[model samples]
Target: MPDGLILPIANQKDYIRAALEAGKHVLSEKPVAKNLEEAHELITCDTETDWRKNPVHQGGFLLDGGVHYVAGLRRLLESQPSSKVCRLSSFTTLLQSHLPPVDTINAILKLESGVSGTYQQSVGTSLTGSEWTVGYEHGVVSVAGSKVVVTVAGNTEVNIIEDERTGVPPVVRIWAEAIAAGITVKDLEPEEALADLEVLELMLRSGESDGLSMSCQYQHIVSNPN
Candidate 1:
């Protein structure tokens, strides 16, 4: 497939490796890999264990769909490690009978960029369309349904995107455009994504295992992206 894109639907590590070996770029789903070991295998590079601090809060959004949100926030701010720190404080609760081992979570994340926010997530709640709200120092931008609401300074504004598909976001379109223009997609590169995976895995470890529970309960299972 010349002049084509390889979108890896699942079996992420193998698919991504094949695409890269074939000289193609990949846009993979979140979490990158099943676990830190598998993720490292996908990267084919040595990643360091550099912890900024000890565990402050530790928990998971079921099987770490938290990765998606965390990755978004990091990319939105172009988060760089070794200088920027993400401190996570997490608490878990069980509300549904058939939920993941760790279902509900509330996390307070303080980024070194002076961006502090709370993420509340649950597999126990009613499933609505996904919503992402980014708050910068100036104001905030929130996307709900097909509408984007921006509140900055002393004013509020809303823009409705006609015929928008929730599953395909503008970011994907930007990626495609960059590829078409023969420009490098910097942030979504494999190495850059590995950085996100590193932080997310650390956060998951700290929050889920309390930085100590891996001895007995670290069962590796393929996560359902529901």
Candidate 2:
């Protein structure tokens, strides 16, 4: 909660910690917290319910926020029986003003079987595109603008072409299903999300050091999950 907003604590660290301690499922704003430690604790905790903290919604980007990309990754990983993430990459833009300013850049995530491509924005012209593409062992998955397309190497091309409108679509619905089924549902589970946060932290740190490689260490300690 931010100071003036009647939000619990403006510091994301405090907000997330309190939410977990209270055993309340949460759907937070994007860029979950200010740092990785807060995000890590929020995600890694062995909670008994589903909690979502995404800045995209809070930032007013609607469903096209960070949630979409993470959800997509989760879908690919779960649907593929033998798939794993190999590596991931992201690209961002500093020049966005026409629409939402997506402070977070692009991401390229590599799965054991292939790669996942994601682009996000906060403020850019509607004409500017925000898309996601996944390359799997069997085929390729591409989501451009409001359309989703999938093509398998030898299988028939099943095109899921539609318009983007209203609340959660297939992406968020997946998480909803997991929750309804009493399953611990999280796109890039807490720990994994924290890992991604740390990766971003390292990237920023490295950039600050003129692209010189650097190490990231977490100082906020959590009680053992055991």
Candidate 3:
């Protein structure tokens, strides 16, 4: 039997449960599951297949791609102990005919620590820029394309990271290391992935409800060591 299982997004529930039952560690691609119910099943058990473009798959490419942004946003906010997202309101729409179901989302998120932020994602926009910015009490960090700029006290610092394979390699390395050491990495845990999915799913649900406020159920708050 293989020591670990790396699975694609399709039919993940069965595969993850089977692998876990076989005593193998598993790493599956994003979104975790199609919905919160399926995600919960996988937590008791648990990407992209061509079905990603099919409307039956729900949110189509939005769900396929949006999970990454949600995960990144969660990581950024969780830098503090009480920063987990507690609720959100969102609006979603399809900006391009080619991207079915929906291809854009704009959301307002409120964190457990009482901080708030905006999240916007679009796959079919004429706009030509990419950025993920997080503001802190003392500074702001903005990542755009290959550069990360940090502004603090009126001073700005920039760092260029030109890796095209950015997050994949590091996550794969961590998963491998965790497996080899027979331990779980907190970030790679199924629950963490589920939390990521929960945020996205609620956003989609909120979008479908015309931006009704949705509460998050799976956010995991990490305690600060200090």
Candidate number achieving the greatest TM-score relative to the actual structure: 3
Model 1 misplacement above 4 A: 2-11, 22-25, 45-65, 79-85, 127-140, 167-182, 210-226
- lDDT (Cα, tens digit) per residue for candidate 2, span 1-226: 3121124323655665666666654545445554565565665553533343321122234222444455444544556543444444444444545444334444444444544444343444445555666665688777765566778876645455564564335535665565567565444245544543454544333333444533434312232221
Model 3 agreement with the true structure over 1-226: per-residue lDDT tens digits: 3354554566677876676565555667888888778877876652222211221357878788888878877876777778999999999998898898889999999998888889898888877666798888899999887789999999999999877556777888888886677565688876787889888888888999999999987786342111
lDDT of 3 at 49: 27
Total clashing residue pairs per candidate? Answer: 3, 40, 3
TM-score of 2: 0.52
C-alpha lDDT of all candidate models, in order = 0.56, 0.47, 0.78
The candidates, ranked best first by TM-score, are: 3, 1, 2
Q: Scored by Cα lDDT, where does model 3 land?
A: 0.78
TM-score of each: 0.62, 0.52, 0.84
The RMSD of every model to the true structure, in order and in angstroms, is 10.0, 7.9, 7.2
Q: Which of the predicted structures, 1 or 2, would earn the higher lDDT when compared with the native?
A: 1
* Ten-residue region with minimum lDDT total, candidate 2: 54-63
Q: Which of the predicted structures, 1 or 2, would earn the higher TM-score when compared with the native?
A: 1
- Candidate 1 C-alpha lDDT tens digits along 37-68: 77667655222111101111123344446666
Q: How does model 2 fare in lDDT?
A: 0.47
